[model samples]
Structures are given as C-alpha cells and as structure tokens.
Target: MMKRIPIALYFLLAGLCAAAQPKKLDIVFIGNSITQGGGLQHPLEEAPPVKAWEWLKRAMPGSNIQYSNQGVSGSTTVDFLPATNKLFNNVVKAADAFKADKDATLVFSMVLGTNDSAIEGPNGSPVSPEQYRLNVKAILDQLLSSYPGCIIILHHPTWYSPNTHNGARYLAEGLARLQSYFPVLDAIVAGYRSTHPGQVYTGYTGGFSYFKKHPELFIQENGRSGVFQLHPNAKGAAELGVFWAQAIKKVVGRLK
Candidate 1:
C-alpha cells in the first residue's frame, strides 16, 4: 500500500513539467517559386528543401513551434510588402485576428532577389539595388513592429544559368546580384537591429559559388517534369534547406 500524493502536489508537478518545455515559436517562410517548392506538382507531404521548418522539426523534436509557407510562384518583394491584398499584410492581420500568443516567439525566413535581378534593361537593371534595399527595409520595419522581438532571416536565392540562353538575362546574374544587392540588404538588417543584434540575418544559398565552380554546367537541371536550371530540383532544394537550416538553428539556440 503506497501513500497517495496530494492533489496540489500533482498540479504543481504538472505545471513544472510544462514550464520546462522550450518556449513556443511561430515561423513564417515567404518567397518565390523555389519557396513554393519549385513551381511543380510534388506530393503535398514531401516538404520542400528550402523550408527550414521541416528541418527544425527533425532537429528539435521536442520544441513547440508552428510553421507556414506563404510563398508564391514568380512573386517579387513588392508582393511581400504590407499592402492591402499582399502576403505580408495578410499574414500579420490573420495572426492578429487569431490572437497569436503575445509571449510566443516569431520567426520570418524570407528568400527574395531572384526575379528582381532579372536584367530587363540594357543597363542590366530589373530592380536597382537601392530600390531592393528600400523594399526589403519596408517589409522588415513592418514585421518588427507587428511582431515585436521577431527574428528575421533573409535568404539569397540559388544560382541562375550563366549562358545568355535568355540573352543577357542574368549572365552571371547570381554573382551580380550578390555583389550589388547583398550589401544593401545586409546594411538594412544591421540598421534595424543595431541596438539588439541576432534579430536578423542573411542566408546565402551558395548559388553563385556552386555555379561558379561548375563552369561547364549552365543550369541546375532535373529530368523531372517542369524542373529547370534556375529552379532547383528536389535534391538542390534539399541542399538549400540545409543552408537555411544552418541560419535558423542559430536563432533556435537562443530561444528559451
């Protein structure tokens, strides 16, 4: 015959155990076709390689977190700006409507700057670096305000084909975008979190380096339907997911 524990003791023990769990977090991934899982029809459950959420789930099995993919095919940064019908506004407004817990941590994983770098003009300007910086800052400022203390992770999309298969399109566009736009974007993130670092980061997905190394290969290709060099195949996507996961893991480590 064992002695029964007091009811108060049981409640207190349960509360302590629950409190021991890591803080819950909500993560949002926003971007273009790659983030939309390569603009193809894959099984719904087969997670995209660019999504760090699934990676996080595997890495931190015990962690409490919610993740969503708000990516669209062929979307530019403008679509993400806090406008009436855009994704940024929609995400924030819906979160507010749902009354997301004030105590829960929020994370934003943003991948952009691909279509923006398309050389639409003779001068090779799709969206100028300055404008890109402005667009990125506007979104960041809005997010920081809407979800105070949220950590922002900005990703540079993977490599583009080197040849002029599209005519001066992004002839070495991956390198051009990195050299031209990455600095401004980094500066903006740094500016926002000057007082409090670790609130923002830039994740380079190695598209430039990978393409530069394989000078002979013009594209990252998959024989699978609708897969192309500009868009990564499942394997390429998974590789990107690794890069993104590295960036997010740093933030996850800090969360209590």
Candidate 2:
C-alpha cells in the first residue's frame, strides 16, 4: 500500500495535466457575395455562405467549429467601419459578439476591394490603386485593434467576367494592380503575426493562378461555368475552398 502511493499521485498528476489543455477553436468567416455564394445552383443551392459552412463542417468534422458568415452582397472594405452606420452594423455586431465571447477563438477571413475597384468613387472617378490600398489598410487596421490575437486571412478578389467590358484582359490587369497592394497587406499581417504567431495570412488569387496552370481541375461539366466569370461556380468555389482549407490547416497545425 505504501509503495502504491507515489504511483497513484503520478497518475493523478497526469490526469490534471491532460485536463489543462486548451480546447479547439470555433472559426468565423467574413466577406462579400463570393463568400455568400452569389451564383451557381444545380443541386445544393447557390448560396456561398451555405456552401462554405457546409464545406467547413464536412472538412473539419467533430472539431467543435462554428462558422459564421457575415458576407453582404456588394460590401466594400470601406463599408466595414462606423459601427452605428446601418450599412455596416451587421459586420460590427458579429465582430463585437466574437470579441465578447471568451471561449471562442476568432478566425476572420475577408474578401473585399473588388467592389471598391469596380465602382466609381463619390467623385465619379474610378478608385485608384493607391486609394484601394488605403481602404484595405484602413479596414485591416480597425480589425487588428478590435480583435487582438485573432487569426485573420485576407483574400484577394477573384476574377470578374471576361466578356463584360474589359473582360478577362481587364481581370488580369486588375490582378496586377491588386498584387501591388500586397505589400501593405503584408505589413498588416506581419504586425499581427508578431503578436499572434499562430495566425494565418493567405490569398485565393494564387488558387486562380493554379486554375490557369491546371485547367482540368475545373472542367465544365453539366453545363457548369469555368473561371473568369463575374462569380465562381460550385467547382470554382470548391477549388478556392480547398486552397483556403489547406492554408488554414497549416496555420492551425502550428498553434500551441
């Protein structure tokens, strides 16, 4: 009985050690119509939010994850600030709720700037690259201040319709313009990663490049559309989702 006492204490210590481990996270996603699933419906519905939630659920089963889609159709980076503003309150509410929740670990994934680039400014002038960069930086700055230590993944806007006006040529040009703004984005990510080392910074524009390389990954089956459209079909979204999921998994895997 005396000899067993130390062994029992050791076992008790191990049990407590196991109990002290932190719980897995519940992630949140924020973005635009792309995140909300604007088009492409054949069987599962044409909603990006619904499809994204479904994908996350299926991809990370039993991981105790909760995905909240706060994507409004036609929202710009400039629209995220001003909490009292009717147009942006929904996003503010979601961010506030995440902040208030102690148990939840926030993961913010946003896809903006597309609308800002597409729409003319109040002066009826097309938003310049410099202006777009400033708008993106502003939104990221606010997010960092509000949600310190939270993981953030910023996605570049995907391709637009190739036939609509400038078409694919215009989208390709837009990508070049967008890449120039990546340094600003990098600064933001670096600032956050300095504190929250476990956080992720990823882009789906690379995935678009991948599609260009391997067109077979996105075959036009059952009358489904291909890339360079105004919006992504299920196939396009799935491809992008796979890239995002992989990036996220890599980030989460390194968390302590």
Candidate 3:
C-alpha cells in the first residue's frame, strides 16, 4: 500500500510540473514608425520588438519566442481600422503566420497615437480623443473576434517634443491631445474586463513619463519648428523593449 501511494504522489507532482512549464510565445507587434524603429541604422536588429524578444530570451532561457514587427511608418489608429483593409490586414496575416504553432500562445503588442495627435500629418491627423477611443476599440474588437484565445496589449504612445514639426506638426496642443488619449486607453482596457475578461490588457505605459524626465533617450532631430525629439535612440529602444518585456512577462506569468 505504501509503494502504491508513493507512485501516485510522484505522478501528481510530475503532472503539476508539466502544467507549470511556460508556453511558447508568438508575439505580433503592431504600431507606427516608433515600433518600426524608424531612422535607426539597423532597424531589424535594434528595433524594440527584437530587443524585447532578446530580453525574454535572457529572462526565460530556453523558452521559445517568436515575434513579427508589423509597425508601419506614419500609420494611425484610423488606418488600422477594420474597414481600411490596409494595416489591419497585414496584422491578420502576421497573426495567421503563427497559427501553425499550436503550442505557442499568441500576443499582440501595440503602440500608436503619435501621428494621430499631429496637427497636420498622418492618415488621421488631429484625431479627437473620442474618435481615437472609438478607433482603438474597433481595432481591438476585430482582433479579439479573430483571435479569440490570443492576448492583446495596448501600449500608450511615448513622448514627443511639443514643438515637433517636421513632415507633421505636433505642437503643444498636439501634446495635450496625446496626453488625453492616455486615460481613454486605460478606460478601454478596464471596460474589457467585463467584456473580454482577461484577453485584453494595458502594457508599458511609462514611456511618456520616463522620456519626459529623460530627454537624452530621444534622437534629437531638426524639425520645421526647430530641434525636436520624437524617436528613441538605440539605448532608448532597448529600455523601451525592457518595459514591454517586463509587462509581457507579468501577463505570461498570470497564464501559468
């Protein structure tokens, strides 16, 4: 009787350990030029998504992680809307590519709104806060419907100089408008608790506040207004990736 009891306990422990093992991650990054690693010398290697994947590799050693960077230059929430059939379709394609890995859990990480707040550039310039909320919701709705088991993480857009005016014009007013979207994003994620449950979450919201305090992280550029900072330098991109990886790690942990 004692030998039989030991065998049963061993099997139970083994099952628990197997269940505790981490699942492979298949992440699809969706956003704008910042996410595309715009103006970087080696965007493919130095991009935030790549850096985030690197971070996860180190943190979880031996875990399988795959990512696709689908960020488009000058894209907006409006451009990614379901009806547009442009950027949104690309995202769907990217997600579909990972469907073959049945053992992998899918995740979508998004960062946008920099161009949307612009006074004059991007597909949807000067997007009202209300409109931005609706646009984001619509995108999330489609994503959730399509990838029912996947997780979606909405990252608030980072900081840009108030006088930023190169191809687009995001002055002080634009910055204010950009800040307004923060709360809206939070509300959207919170609302999903009742609607989508644990499928949707907010990720890495410290970029704006952190970059505001540390301007050196940004790549200083000459805009129409004067010298301005919008994109992140290599170091900044690495740090931003860490932010995302940490957030993702937490979300992944919850799954276990």
Index of the highest-TM-score prediction: 3
lDDT of 3 by residue, 61-139 (tens): 6578899999899999999999988899999999999988888989999998999999988887899999999999999
lDDT (0 to 1) per candidate: 0.64, 0.56, 0.89
- After superposition on all C-alphas, the RMSD of every candidate to the true structure, in Å, is 7.7, 7.4, 5.2
Q: In terms of lDDT, which candidate is stronger, 1 or 2?
A: 1
Give stretches of model 1 more than 4 Å off.
1-22, 46-51, 93-99, 121-125, 164-169, 173-175, 204-207, 211-228
Could you give candidate 2's per-residue lDDT for residues 1-256 as a string of tens digits?
4655588899898666444432445556666666666555642354444555456556555445555667666666666644426435675577676676676567777776555554332221234666666666666666666677777787666544432222212334444554555555666566666655656476444744555455443323221223334556677766666666555655554555
lDDT of 1: 0.64
Tell me the number of clashing residue pairs for each predicted model: 0, 4, 0
Name the weakest run of 10 consecutive residues (lDDT summed) in model 1: 218-227
Comparing candidate 1 with candidate 3, which one achieves the higher TM-score?
A: 3
Score residue 149 of candidate 2 by CA lDDT: 70
